[model samples]
Target chain A: MLTAILIMTGIAIVLGAALGYASIRFKVAGDPLVEKIDAILPQTQCGQCGYPGCKPYAQAISNGEADINQCPPGGEEGIRKLADLLGREVKPLSEEHGTEKPKSVARIDEQVCIGCTLCIQACPVDAIVGAAKQMHTVVAPLCTGCELCVAPCPVDCISMAPLAETVETWKWKYPVHELRSAA
Target chain B: MISRLFNFRGGVKPESHKTESSGTPIDQAPLPKRLVIPLRQSIRSTARCLVEPGQKVLKGEHIGQGEGSLGTGVHASTSGTVVEIAPYPMAHASGLETLSVVIAPDGEDRWIDRVPFDYRKVSREEALGWLRSCGIHGMGGAGFPTHVKLGSGTGIDTLVINGAECEPWITCDDRLMRERAAGVLSGAMILRELIGARRVLVGIEDNKPDAIERMRAAASTIGDDVAVVAVPTLYPAGGEKQLIRVLTGIEIPQGKFGTDFGVQCFNVGTAHAVHRAIHFGEPLLSRIVTLTGNVAHPGNHEVLLGTQVAELLALAGPKADTDRYIMGGPMMGIELQSLGVPVTATTNCIIAASPTLFPPPPPEQPCIRCGECARACPADLQPFELYWFSRAKNFGKAQEYHLFDCIECGCCAYVCPSHIPLVDYFRFSKGEIWARERERTASDQARARFEFRNFRQEREKAEKAAKLAAKAAETRAKLPEAAATAAGTAAAAVAAEPAASPEDLKKALVAAALARAKQQKAAVTPKNTDSLSAETQAEIAAIDARREKRNTQDADKTP
Candidate 1:
């Protein structure tokens, strides 16, 4: 009985020391889990889910502060990816976020526009450029077309325009795969 | 056993008939009278066309320049006249139209006062920038901007000059390194200095002893800054990622770059160009092209940009009645539709061939479980599964199987018992996934923007209603006092004022909606809630107190 007690005590002390050492030695500075989650998120700062950017949404998801379904811009697929990352059930996009639509950008018709720069200030990505009284123009490449600009246009000059596709910008999506035996 | 920790798989291996043309030093092909130089040479947005149609241009004159940091300028391939500017057939199998500037050579390859280099007099950054203006890109296939490659500001510990020339039947780099080892070595020194590396590793395959000796002597003269390390002659040793692995035993993780490993690999040919750019002030306007196979005179040629394949193939001796043409090496080079495919910076080997040079691939058959393909897969992916999945267009499941990981090296198909074109499937799968991702991202962005806009609109509508109601209440309160006898008459007029002006009513509504939106925005934060007017809070508290008091009074009455 005495020998068994001594062996058990020795084993416990060694295990405890090992665990303590490992806790300090392998400690990562930043949360790798959060970094990985952030990497997968689309960086569009359209705040449709009420969060400012994908990183904030990732943080909110990590902290259990926000639902992953709030971002309509992520759409059903994005929500699914977030769900998988968070190990939560995928939920349908909340109707409060509005329905999914094709990507478009706000543009002011130069001829019709009265040199109002309200849209410029309202643009989150700073995709618009014009003086307060100058004819506004959209930097097509920079425009995410969040339509944040459209609401602020006093003259109601800004309208949404569909993005044009070209041969270079077009990339084919990945095809499907069937799970098979590794022979 | 080799540790399969590196999860690369599902590569296709085509018949590598490399030895056919890689036997001797590059020979010269007669320069064509005219060279059609395109403004956009590298993988960047096309340069703006500067010379109008019919404008005379000199050999060293600037044709056009790239827009952003990743772009390189286009120079005259030869003293030429700008003939046309429009989308022309590109050097791709798709025969895709890309914006090109056609230049007709005047044949007088006159020199523009070229800048000669004095190493002691110039700074390294200036040399690199001058090379960019001269338009040097990686000549070993992926024509990434050479300046961009050198400009990676990482504190490189090692400079890897890839002299392996592993791609079969492509000896342009080999020929350049062998004939001009001094120049190639000089370029390596420039790269070493640019990267600030303590050690320079010139990785050459053991196959070329002649080239190895030349480079070894050059490195010795340059002190111990650069060392010539000959690796075992293996196929694809020249592949940038694979070469880094073979030398350093370090895997560059996905989405991470080679510079991340403190090692940047450059083709020996590219290093030669860097030497010319730094030393001679010469832009990469020309390159050594291997012209062999199905030709009467089988030799390598130094080619200028915009030289039609037809012209080179003609110089190489016309293809026989049964001849087919390929660009680059036989293994990875593209098969040309006609000899008309304009030679870009990417073109190194143009394989004009008959059945003897490139036998047609046999009809694909079902896998008999021989597993020869698995052994050949450089990427180690189960291509059999990918093939089935891609055929079904099941991209999600294909991605789950790590379709994005395949480098499309084309090894599995070479050793397959049934020669399946695995690269095509991988490419198709990758393309599909990219398209779907782009589609999803676009739609998601649209939806979010739409919701936010509607929220603004809804708030505007509600505000207008509130403002009008407040205005009506104000008018009604003052009407009776202001007009005692004409109280009812004035009341009607006041009501008309609120009803008559639709524009004013809309503006007032929008203001009210803006206030509501501000309130909604504030609800999400503690600061916003705390900063709310005390009166509003008191009113809410009072309403709650009144409801409680009324409920108690009602309860007492009920008893």
Candidate 2:
């Protein structure tokens, strides 16, 4: 009986050492869960989730400091995706954060722009290009519709214009079944 | 000679209503008063518009030059003055407007100087480039640039000319082969010579006997080894992959080209266009359009590229009860929003849809797992599962079921007992997946830019700090040297004062710099508002308060 017990202990100690060595050798730097969560989050960098950016918000979520429903730019769909990823129940988007709106890009009224670079400094994605005391223009394709630039504009020249549907951008809508609806 | 043919998977045999339009010979459509030519005629990059508003252009003038290798040139159909370059309704299902060059015809169908080149005299690359400049695209509804397909002809062994006009009520190809079989054969021979293919096979549906007979006669006259084989009459037999399979017994997998299988397929109409461009030095300015369905005279007419659909219908004597127009054929066609849309390079047929002739589809019923769609799918994909996944917005699951393999063929929908628009669901799923992918790419780009901006700002701050530190060290070094020099020249008491510790001197410098910055800030005052009146100041205060309130409201509204 003593021999069996000693043999079992020996096996346990060896396995423990192997696992300990593995933990050190294959140690992953930074939280991979945060990177995954950040990927799922629409990288709008709008800070609508009460965080500085998407990465910080992802870190907060992984730390259990922020709720999955706090992201308004991601909308209810995003909440569902996060819930699925984290194995949590899907919840409605939090109203205190904001409401979901159609994707848009910021447009600056060049005539009204007072040659101030305040909007350029305020852009999160650096989509606005200008120098000090120079008229600024927003690169429409890059602007994440963050609205961060609009408030900082001294002349209030910036406006969010919803993307227009063209032939290339047109999408086929979901098919509605009348018979199923009646049933 | 009887060539061994291969059969494809599930397909449906719909009633062919082609007899109505196939009886008459092809006729030339009258020149439209104004032609609205869209620059994006091919499936790839759009052509760059060369003519501006009010510019005079002769017939066959290069109005839009091809942008890239995949792009094909666009030509003026008739002598006209460019009226305007603006967005006009296109012959697309979306009914969206595209940039179009509108030209008013000058009643003179003047031709540009035509210099027909002998392909035999020039290098193969030069010949292909000539075809690109001629704007010869596949007239088989895909509008793929002919040059790109011919350029990738290194490993191609068999060239299959698709004459299988299988879509119901569309006989443009059938009419073309019957009337201009020699031209089609000549073009095929040229293509064979260019690609250096050993054998040429022409696959025509058995339903169109006249086209087969005429093509065979033309092949014998040319004394070339072009086999005109009439395969079984099957719907979608004219499909590029399907026709390729029927001719060469090769199944090209999804996301792969037919050249990988040592075969290349070209439409019969495309072959004719190639002939006209190479032999006659003519660009693809007109195509044989089948004008049928709810029209008094249902026949085929060689219509110009930018002819308005309404004007083409009028020539066919569209019935008064005609309610709508459908482009292409019944199986794979889009209901045009308005007849005012211009005919593009891909516009092969225009069916005047009416209530009595073509009734609306019955209300869609839930799928009972009947598997009829699966039985009718030519691509052999599971349509029912795709429909369910797409409806649930589970794009990942839909993709898992090989959703992209679906060619948007209406066979599944055509056979579905529930009358579900299966193709529409597939299209919706594909569009959503593409759109999501595009959004992801854009977001990735934005994230990179944001991170780079942050990195740059941090770098700038570090650079400034380093410069300041270097300046302080230089000052410190100079002070010690000066103090040593003073010790040698004057009394030792000056150097014996402990030299005022470097820490103390650095602290004093920082304090002095801060004090100077504060003085500068105090000196800078408001220039315009310095001498403002009391009323103006009050008004400015009120405006500031209002602005503050509005900003908060705006922030609240932002998502």
Candidate 3:
């Protein structure tokens, strides 16, 4: 028993020392799982997710504190991807947050400007450009339609506008049999 | 020249309607008053308009610049003044609009200064660069830039010129070979020289003996490198992969090109255009289009690019009952959305639709899982499996079945007893897959942007917190000893000391609880009794007497 105990003690000490060295030598700085989950999200920076931003929501998801269905901007497809990545059962989207809509960009009516810098502060992506008391304009491509800026604006000049489909961006819709019969 | 030609796995024999279009000699189309030239003609095209409205352009003058290395250039088909530069309907299967340059042709049809490149004096790369600027592309429906195709021509062995115009009613290639045999052979020689190939094999379908004879005569005049051979007249024997397989007996691997196997293919019309571009300094401005079906004169015409289909149909004399038009052969053609859409490099045939000649497809029936479609697939793919997966939207399974390997040849559709539009399903699935991939890329980019924004916000917050902490530390360090002692004493007064023992803590807690109970009882005492009526006072006195008696009885019982 003494010999066995001594051998086990020696093995434990060696393994513990190796593990300690490895922990310091090859330390992972950030949570890669959170990073992967964040990568899967639509980077709308639209806090329809209860969290402050996509990264925080991703961190919460990695920590098993947030449900994958809370993000309306990510939509069903995003939820499906997250479920596939995290090995969880797919669930319906939680209706309390919002519903998934077609992609849009936040457009500001520059003419109705009472440019309180409140909107500038609330924007996560910094897509809106303006001075403290001047008119503001939205860079359409960069704006994520977060709607976070809309609540902060006193004049309520900001609104989400659906993107126009050009020939380049047009997608082929599935043909319906009933529709074909009319043709 | 005839060799032991090998056969591919599956192909159907469609009726060759060549005599309908090939009866007469090829004719030159009358220059229209206006030409609406679409800037984009090739796949993944990025043609940028170079001229503004009202700018005078000569015939063969470059009117659009190629935006990317793979983009094809566009030139004026006839000397004309630019009338409009705006979005117009283009001849595409999707019936979409593209940015086009509208030119009103001048009656003179003036030519620009011509400068031909000497192939023997310059490097093959330089010759190809000249060809790139000439706006030449494959006229075999694909419209691929010929320069890019010949870019990888180094160390190639065999160059196969596809002269097999095997589609049912399309005889553009047949007429091009019969009319311009010498020009086609010259372009083939240039191709063979550029690719440094040992031999050039021209595969024309045997049904067109006139084209075969003319091409053979032209080849004999030119040296021994060019051999004009006749392939068996089969539906889609003119297909790039099919013709390659028939001539060389090599099945090009999936997701690979003909050049991957030391072979390359070009259309005879493309060769003729190359000859004109290199020898005559002309760009691909016109193409021989077959105008047949519900037309009085069913023949081939060398129609200028950007000529409206309506104008071309008028020249061919369309029947009064012609309801629609197809841009290519009936087997793989798309119906024209409007007759006003202009033709492009890929428009080889335009069939005016009538009730008798072109009837609507029968209503689709349920797939019986018969293996006939599989046997008829030219690419040797299982059509029923693709059909089921696509219909079910199981794209992953469809992809696993090599759905993209399908050439969209319509062979399976032609042979299907169910009359199902298999090619349409394939096209729809491909478009969906492409759109999904684009969305995935966009999502990834958005994620990066969001992550970066979050990171910046976090860093800013951390910096703010650190600055506040530093400010507080600075203020504390600036205070003298006496002030620090005074601050410490004030802080100590507010901070209560801990209990010394468990008994002391219990006694303190019990005293606090008794005091709280007594305070609560005192607060519940009745108020404002001075305004009571006389009867109320008497009732209160009686209740009080009863309470006192009850209290004495309870006390006695407890004792």
Candidate 4:
């Protein structure tokens, strides 16, 4: 009984020391789980999740302050992915944030734009380019379809145009199989 | 010579309707009223448009310049004036519009200055660039740029020319070999010289006896040790990997090039185009398209690249009940969106499909685990499992089963007991996977940009703070000097009184500095006021008085 106790005590102390050293040596500087969650969230920066950006939202989720179903741009597909990652039950999207819509980009009406630079300032991704009192244009590829620039346009010149499907962007649809029962 | 041949597992033998179109001689199609040539001809990159609207172009003039080594040049099929450069419906599975150049033919049939390419005089890289300029792509319906395949020509020992023509009702290659055997041989010889290969083997399906005899006779005349061997007639035998396996007995692993196996494969039609490009200095402006399926005069015609499918089908006398048109073979062809779509470089066969000829597929049924698809898959993959995984939307599981290796040959679908469209599911799964990958990349890029913007904003704030701090430091540095001067001047005044302490000297210095600031403020004059009228000056004075009263009131409240 004495030898067993001594051996057990010695093993526990060695293992504890090794674990303590490993924790310090392999210590991550920041919450890496937040980074992984941020990778899963679509970086639209639309604040639909009630956070300032995707990173802040990820931090909130990591802290258990935000729900996973709040992001509408990520849609149901995103909620499912988050649920899979967090080992939680999949939930429907919240009703208050926004409904999922087709992907679109902002287009500026060059004629009506007064060159006030308001929309440019409102753009979160810096996808708009122009000088003060000059016509502003949106780089379609860079625009994240956040709808943040629409409200700031004084002349209501900025419109969210749904992206048109071309040969390059076409995708094959899922095949639907209808099965008839033997009964 | 009887060369030993290898066989690929899991292939189905459907009834071949080659005799319907292969019996007729090749005919030259007349110039149409308009030709709409798409800029995105090859698979890699789209050619940049060189000719604008209203520009007159010769028959062989390069209207679209190839982008890079992978891009092939596009030429005007006939001398004409470019009517418009706009988007038109393309012959694709998606039936979407692509950027095309519309030309109204003038019927002049004029030619540009043709000069033969002397490959012996120039470097291999230069010759390959010339080939890219000649618009030579694999005409076997893949439309892969030939120069890209030939560029990596080192370590290649055998050049296999594919004449299998395995797909049913596609006999353009068969007719080409039977009629233009010499040209194909010459192109093979050119490829051999360019790649420095020791042997050339032409693999034709045993179904095409006449083509084999003619190619053998032509090879004998060339005396270049070219071997013309016949392989078993099987569906998809003409596939690049399949033909290579049959000719050289080498299985190219997935994601690897055939050149890595000391062999390179080229279609017979591609070989003929190479001969034309090098010997006659002609670009790939036209191709021999097979017109068959529910037509009165089924034959092969060398149609120009941009001719409308309707016009070409009219020559073949399509029946009145024809409902649709298919672009490639019946096994792997896509149903054309409209008859108005133009024939592109990859168009080898156009089938006027009718209800009687090609009926609708039966309604899909649930899988019973028959395993017939596995027996019929040419790539030796399990099709039933892929179908289930794809049905369940489990892309990860499908990928684990090597879903990408399934070459959508329709063999599994043709043999499925449940009439399930297996290829469609595979296509959907592959597309979903690609789209997901693209989204991930896009999200990663957006994240990087967002982070960079945040960093930049933080840097700008820090820079502004530093500038303000530096200015405050400068002011503080100058204040000590001003205070010392005031203390020095007041030292004489303090000496008359009793000995003053250091605290008293500091107080006197601050008071003198405040008095100097007040004097300086009073001495300053406002510009643009000297030339103003008396009334304007009086108004400005009233405004200043109101501002001063408000400032005193604000200070009183705060204190």
Alpha-carbon lDDT, every model: 0.71, 0.87, 0.84, 0.88
lDDT (tens digit, per residue) of candidate 3 on B226-258: 788888888889899999999989899889988
Q: lDDT tens string, model 2, A45-104?
A: 989899988989999999999999999989988899899999999999999999999999
Off by over 4 Å in 2: A1-21, A177-183, B42-44, B481-496, B502-559
Give the winner by lDDT. 4
lDDT string, candidate 1, B282-367, tens digits: 87777888877777656677887788888887766855654678787666676786655678878888877688666777877775
Q: Can you rank all candidates by TM-score, best first?
A: 2, 4, 3, 1
Q: What docking class should model 1 receive? A: incorrect
Ranking by DockQ: 2, 4, 3, 1
Candidate 2 residue pairs in clash (backbone atoms < 3 Å): none
Candidate 3, residue A152: the lDDT equals: 85
Residues A64-104 of candidate 4 have per-residue lDDT tens digits of 99999999989999999899989999999999988998889
Q: Which ten residues in a row are the worst by lDDT in model 2 chain B?
A: B486-495
Tens digits of per-residue lDDT for model 2, B1-559: 4458899988889999989999999998888988989988743458899998989999999998889778878899999899999988888888888888999999999999998879999999889988988888888867888888886558888999999989999999999999999999989988998898978899999999999999999888775567999989989898888888887788988778788888888888889888888999999899999999999999999988899988888889989898888999998899999777988767889999899988999888889999999988888799999999999889999999999998887999999999999999999999999999988998899889888988998999999999999997876666534444433444234444565776755544454456557767999988998999999999999999999999999999996
The CA-based lDDT of model 3 is what? 0.84
Residue B466 of model 3: what lDDT? 100
